[model samples]
Target: MVLVQTKIVFHVDELNKWPEVLSNVTNVLMDLAQHDDHHIQMVVVANGDGIMGYLIPSINDQISELAKTVEFHACHNSMVSHGLNSARIPSGVHIVPVGVIDLASLQDNGYRYLKP
Candidate 1:
């Protein structure tokens, strides 16, 4: 059997523009779902002020549903600083210790790195 992996890391921590980041994130996820043929693993490393941007209902829903087909995660550090509980972020967004590490490890294992 063949194992296929599509790894995506949403690095929203480095941006100052929340709306633009949200827009781009949603679009990238949508494109990934529509274009990919193998298994997808999506990890969102939301840090800094961008945490609030991902709390949008529409974006959350899109990502939540996509989680059924893709692995989803958010940085616990960001959740703490933003005063957001796991319940507040999207339903399928898993909490991770470090987003950068997660992304790096996945890439090192052969998952592609994409930033939109």
Candidate 2:
């Protein structure tokens, strides 16, 4: 059996430009998915206004499809602080307890870190 391992951590804190950041991150993620690196995951730690901005979806449909190959994780701490629940997260979003955890686990597994 082959084990696919590669992770990306996105620590998003800024509120204003987060939307654009998320969109670009989505693009890179899609690119990774389509590339030889088939196993790619995205851990998005959104705090403060970052939560609102991180929800943007990728533009290209192929990117959206490729996104399925990537795991999208949201920081639960932000959600709670923002008074948001799993229901509040847009479609295709996964909620994690915190970015710290996302880093410890996913990063330990060879996931790269991205600020956007």
Clashing residue pair totals per candidate (backbone < 3 A): 0, 1
Regions of model 1 farther than 4 Å from truth? 1-8, 14-44
Q: Residue by residue across 3-88, what tens digits does model 2's lDDT show?
A: 56566777766666555655766686657657673665665666666775544543224224534555556678887887888776
The per-model lDDT (C-alpha) reads 0.65, 0.64
RMSD of each: 4.0, 4.4
Pairs of residues at least 3 apart in sequence or in different chains that clash in candidate 2: 7-111
TM-score, per-candidate, Cα-based = 0.64, 0.64
* Model 2 misplaced regions, further than 4 Å: 1-6, 26-40, 54-66
Candidate 1, residue 4: the lDDT equals 60
